[model samples]
Target: MVGLTYKILPNLTAYGGYSEANRAPTPLELNCSSPTRPCILASTLISDPPLQQVASHTIETGVRGNLAIPAGGTIDWKAGLYRTSSTNDIIQLASLVLGTGYFTNVPETLRQGVEAHASLSIGAFSAYINYAYVDATYQFSGTLSSPFNPYADANGNIFVHPGDHIPGIPRQQLKVGGDYAFTPEFKAGFDVLIVGSQYYVGDDSNQNPQLPMYWVANLHASYQITNNVQIFGLINNLFNNHYATYGTFFDQTTDAQFAGNPVNFVSDPRTITPAQPIAFYGGVKVTF
Candidate 1:
């Protein structure tokens, strides 16, 4: 497939674009400063620049194919790709809590990723395996980490731009699962999901030490004793594996202050509660 897009607009000012122009500073600054720290009392102004005409465009293309097999069975395969590039129409002026002493413009960023999968099926039995990979990230050209929060700053100062490799997104993964019919009256299936270690979002660091990859297995089986009744069982995290699907690492948490926390720029990662604690359920499944 292929596609195109277009947009138009004019450049605008940054967060602290107008400090003394178009409007005067608030009375707080006029009264708070004592000629010693004028900057500390001054309030920066931020307003969207006058609307302007802008232009935009996009292009995409890909290919796909499939095939069939005999004995009421089939195998399939395909591949495709897309490329997109876009830029905001207006030039945005921004402020900095660190004044000219720190932070700078946020660099333009580009991200791309791809995925593919295939499966086969015959009669009541079928098997499938799928995998996807992505490398989405943002790049900052002339700025460093600014701990300041955006919403709290009124002057637009506090320009805090962090570096690349955001946490939570994985770079690579692999999965495989299949099921078959046993005498048609009895059937079973299983699945396993695996993920590689990720990074923590803050301070821009590899998450490996905090987030580790682990395998989770699942099992399901069912047997029909009559045309209208059957028995089935399900086991998730079959081995009662202890793993973390999601958690947080804090360096200044209460636990860190007392438990002494891990040294060497260390942090205490949160614990995750699993869904099943090696429990079981049995009952008769009915069919009409």
Candidate 2:
């Protein structure tokens, strides 16, 4: 690993770095490489096949600075760009069997992105915002089994090509929050997170409907009661926003209509785990 930094200005600095790393395949990944003999990961191990180690190379550069407001507050901000490429990257592909998958190495994969953050402070109040944009994709061509995906070929295999967006990774994300101090002993803060949409799991071919975007907000407060004790309150999902963080294809045994027909046993393939609703909690913290 190598890195360098330069003072471009009185209150500004520039930095860049490059690094290389390698990771050996885990026991499960090393042993589960057979599509003909799928194992219920951790519960069973049927086949053992050697896999190449994953090697990653990364590069990053950025600029950071601080600015002061003559009349009131000060702002600190930084922005940067980064890219990481991995060779022989291991990936899990869903198989024809329900709730099972096998791990194999892909030729190459890439994850590149830009990130920026800024914060302001004025006397007893401070606020901050952060945002990131990512472009994650496969860099090789291959075929894998995805029986649950509607777009899979007749033999339940999907072909992944170069530049295909990887499943379950959002392209854009943002967060904004603020904190205010009513007094030395009392303070409160709130934050909202926004996430962009991406392809669902098992949609490695980029042929299925992508997940929808969603946002969530939360609030928190704290009061110092003594030198060693304090009280706090939290409210999650402030607006009771409905959302799902993860989604995948599932095989349903029964159809929606339930018409007592033996042949109609395929319901919606999309399955999701819902996010939490509006909830509140209070607690005490001791510094002892």
In order of appearance, the predictions have TM-scores of 0.53, 0.92
lDDT of 2 by residue, 116-208 (tens): 999999998999999999999999898877888888889998999999998999999999999999999999999999999988888999998
List per-prediction Cα lDDT, in the order shown.
0.47, 0.90
lDDT of 2 at 33: 80
Stretch of 10 with least lDDT, candidate 2: 252-261
Model 1 Cα lDDT, one tens digit per residue, 1-288? 323322221221111111111223234323332212224323432331223222223333333344467887876543334333323222222123222111112333333445556677888777776665655354443333322222223432223332355455666576777788987799998877777666433323332344677777788888989999999988878788877665433323444446677533434333343445555666788878
Give the per-residue Cα lDDT of candidate 2 at 128.
Answer: 98
